[model samples]
Target: MQTEIIVAGFGGQGVLFAGQVLAYAAMDHGLHVTWIPSYGPEMRGGTANCTVIIADEEIGAPLVKHPKAVIALNRPSLDKYEPLVTAGGLLLVNASLIDRPVAREDVQAVYVPANEIAERLGDKRLTNMVMVGALLGATGVLEMNAVQESLKAHLPAKHHRLLPANYQALEEGAQIARETLAQAA
Candidate 1:
């Protein structure tokens, strides 16, 4: 299987980190993976995005012009990448930050209130984790267990204490995505 995904948001939203986790998860599952990140000059509020490709065989390129799936964490991100998702692809939007609805009809759009959910979970930083979970749920590109394992492997030892919170955020996002899918069906 081959999956191309784009994750985008402002800096400090963990867009790059989310891509890293997804790439690591793909690697742990023995899949060929590539992750490419881009960001503006400003560190905190600048736009940041990453493209990740996971495949069962060798990957031809690291850049993704049109992705099969997208995780857009803000209105600007959604506006920028929503049109780039291929037809019949998946689009996971962070509803809490993006007030507008998706306009596409061909692709699956799963809206998760990532920021609000993360706030409820007591850590706003887990918003990206929530989006990651929704992406995994909507695309089935990676298992939750694989993502959890990836977190353990990629996160610094000093940050191990936050694993449980991240796990919770992931599960919450997955649940939201599943509910959206069910409603759509």
Candidate 2:
């Protein structure tokens, strides 16, 4: 199983962190993975993005021209990355920050209210976690248990208190996807 994903947004939106968490989950799943982040001038600004590859075999390239999934956190990100999603891929957008719809029928696009959900959870910074949850629920790439464990390992010790809240954010995200998709179906 090979899956390529792009997570992109402005700098302060935690796009990289979301990629890192997904990468960590892939690692914990014992899959060969590579995380290639956009470097140089783009990193200086909030326009951060990364490509993550998880596969059962050696990855041929780290640069993804087409990805199996996309987590777009802003309008610019959605505009830039939405076209790159492959047929039957997943696109999880931060609907709270971006109010656009995917223009492709080849992909399954899910709009997540990350900022609103995070705020409701009492932290406006768990947007990444919210995206994480939607990604998991939408794609089923990793087990929820693996994600929780990865969070525990990836988060700093001082921020242990956030583990539960982060988990909550993730669950809320999943629920949102479940409810919305169910309704659509």
Candidate 3:
């Protein structure tokens, strides 16, 4: 299996962290993975994005021109990357931040109210985890257990207390995605 994914958002939206989690999960699952991140010069509120590639075999490059999946956390990200998704690819949109709907019919678009969901979960920082959960639910690229394990492995010990909340956010996002899939079916 081979999957190329792009996650994009503002600088503080945890886009790179989300990509890192996916890479870690892929590695834990015994797959080859590559993660490349790009961001604007400004630290906060600047554009940020990351490309992740996971494959069962060797990966030749880290850059992705047309990804198989995209997680767009803001309107800018949606505008920039939505059209570049490969045909029949998956596009996960953060509905809370992006009011514009994806226009493409070639790819499946899954909308998750990431910011709102994160807020409801009592912390807005879990937005990326929500997107990741939606991605996992929609694509099944990485198992949920693998993602949870990856989260545990990557988070520093000091922040371990927040794991449950993060896990809840992930599950909530997955539930939203599952509901969307059910409705589509």
Q: Taking the tens digit of each residue's C-alpha lDDT, what string does model 1 give over 3-44? A: 999999888899999999999999998999999886445335
| Regions of model 2 farther than 4 Å from truth | none
**Pairs clashing in candidate 2?**
10-46, 11-46
Candidate 3 wrong stretches, greater than 4 Å: 39-45
How many clashes show up in model 1? 0
Summarize candidate 2's per-residue lDDT along 1-185 as a digit string, tens digits. 88898999988888888888988988988888899899678778669999988898888898879899989989998998888888888889899989778888877889898999999999989998899899888766888889999999988999999899999999988888777678767
Pairs with steric clashes in candidate 1: none
The residue-level lDDT of candidate 1 at 165 comes to: 95
RMSD of each: 1.8, 1.4, 1.8
Cα lDDT tens digits for candidate 3, 1-185 = 78999999888899999999999999988999999987346345488899999998999878878999999999989999988999999899999989988899988889999999999989999999999999988877899999999999989999999999899988988888888888988
